[model samples]
Target: MARKKASPEDKIIDAALKLALAQGWRDLALADIAAEAKIGLPELAHIFHSKADILAAFERRIDAEVLAAAETEGIESESPRDRLFDVLMLRFDALGPRKPALKRIALDLAGDPMGALSLIRPALQSLGWMLEAAGIDSSGLRGAIRVRGLALVWAAAFRVWLNDGEDQARTMAELDKRLRQAEEWKDALSRLRTRKTDDAAA
Candidate 1:
């Protein structure tokens, strides 16, 4: 069977991820990534602006794959929480190949709040899409809160996931527990909102 060649952008992103994982994101350089990808400096520059951009591109690719998986898997029949679980599991599967890189990136950014800050926007975007993929609402003020909250939940699960061994049993357990807790909280908030609405009506 013939091997499918990666696109220019994929080649660049793959090279950058490998370099960042091998070293650290802070030490990654465009020239090195260009060399690793076997592309000229000018060509690499034409594709991405910086290491952060490359990381974001990689994340977007993962997000797209997760969304596609959600559709193909026909998760609409499941409950919202179950749908999200399935979608996220698909995301983890998509990221399976780069788990080591992700773990390294997390460790490198742990003490650097400012460095990790760049990911907040991208994380929010990813969560918003994840919510939508799970057939949940992801718009307006409520959507904003859901996105932020889910991002935190996912982040917590992701930390556990990084250390989880090949079975991923621990990661799945943590994610399920967290999602159940979130659902309980969501229910409580809904009840509170209903009471407030009744009070206002009275």
Candidate 2:
């Protein structure tokens, strides 16, 4: 969908993303974004309190979109691995077309989350619900730990997907590795719980 630049807020966010893509965030300024959007600084400020505010808006906007898409992945395949594969593929499809800007947004996550926990914590809750719905054992798994693990999976898989240049073959290969690693991580976490239980008994 073409971004609507109808409102001052929309225009500013669009401009920031475009400028970030072209010249990097370091090269972007509130004035530059205002100029790109053909709005005045005062106008931009009226719509968004600050440049950081605009970035938070952009990050949050896409975060909601990607999270919804991740949730709506209708993959009832026999395995969670297959479901994960389908989810990752859907995100790639959605993000791949957006081109220049969304990819840059993905890269900026590490540097400027604005409220990473605010976004990701909810996503983790949703994913955990899905996992329980799928009959994945949640016993002994703390939501915070699960959330962090899931975030790592997302961040690592994103790095693999973003830089992949091999017609998606490499991307799928990377996804597969991540999937296997997830299983191993799950096992390790389960063992950690068991060892803690044994230490308590001892």
Candidate 3:
């Protein structure tokens, strides 16, 4: 089957990523992105308000790609951990082509704490979708914990991925290790909650 045509939003995202790879993200202006995308500034503004919005749109695009791939593969019988592992690796695969651009953005954003802080909410929201894709419940207090835990896991793995070779062995190892640690932490938290409930009853 033929691939679907890229939408205007996708075109702008592609242009921004391409520009980020060539010139770095921080110094590139919105006008640069518009010219790169072959669209006028008014059209670009209609789809995206700012560069941050473009980045967020790119993140959402990756999320959708991962989810679509997960749906096609059908890992329903796998354990939650295994499913989550697969889902996250799929996400990495989608991101692999743009690693250089992402690395530049990561380094530039590191100095901008508020910029980094602004992304946390969208990151958590994406992680929540990841949890659901893995057939895990991403709701309520336990879901909140899982989202936060996954955030740490993603951060640790992302740091490794930026420096990882094409084989991605180190990145995969880090992701696996972090997921195991998160599982242990989740179990410990569950036990603590149980203990507190028992004490309350007593």
Candidate 4:
């Protein structure tokens, strides 16, 4: 199959990530990204209002890639936990190449609490898609709990992944352990809810 051409937004995202790798995310201006992308500042502004917007766009792109690949891979026959594991691993695979740039960005963002706060919504949005791709429900109350649980899991594993070697062995181990812990917590919560329901009925 012929490769699809990169869109203007994609070009801008690619340029921004590349610049982040070279100069660190904290130092790059919109104009720098525009120059790197070979697009004028006016054009860049039309596509993205700020660096956070570009980061969100990059995350959305990762979500799309993982969702598409998961659809192709299919995991309907697997257990729910297994399905989620596969989906998340696929996400890590998509993120693998950008690890260095992401590390730099993450380090820079560590000191910027407000900037980190801005990412929460987009991160949750991506995680919701990941849950959906795993054939899991990501709506309403239970869905909200699941999203938060997955967020913690992702956060813990992401820290390990940032420093993990190219083999990703440690990242996979950390992710698996965290997922199991989350599963236990989820099961306990479900049982607690069941007990409350029974008590109310009685």
Q: Each prediction's TM-score against the native? A: 0.93, 0.66, 0.94, 0.95
The lDDT per prediction is 0.88, 0.66, 0.90, 0.92
Lowest summed-lDDT stretch of 10 residues in model 4? 73-82
What is the C-alpha lDDT profile of model 2 across 1-202, one tens digit per residue? Answer: 9865477777788788788888776446788999999988888877776656775565555555555665565457788777666655655665575456757755665576663434554555544543444435434646556545655676666677777764777778877787789879889988999999999999
Report lDDT (Cα) of residue 93, candidate 4: 95
The per-residue C-alpha lDDT of model 4 at residue 55 equals 98
Q: Write candidate 3's Cα lDDT for 121-155 as tens digits.
A: 88899999999999999999989988998999999
Across 57-89, the per-residue lDDT of candidate 4 in tens digits comes to: 999999999999998888664788888888998
Q: Which residue pairs does candidate 2 place in steric collision?
A: none
Tens digits of per-residue lDDT, candidate 1, 1-202, equal: 9999899999998888898888887767799999999999999888888777788899899999988888877786468999898888888889899999888888888977887888778788988999999889999999999998898779888989899988889889999999999999999999999999999999
Predictions ranked by TM-score, top down? 4, 3, 1, 2
Q: For candidate 2, which ten residues in a row score worst on lDDT?
A: 129-138
lDDT for residue 177 in candidate 2, whole number 0-100: 82
Off by over 4 Å in 1: none
Best by lDDT: 4
Which run of 10 residues does model 1 get worst, by summed lDDT?
Answer: 69-78
Candidate 2 TM-score over all chains jointly? 0.66
Local error of candidate 1 at residue 94 (angstroms): 0.9
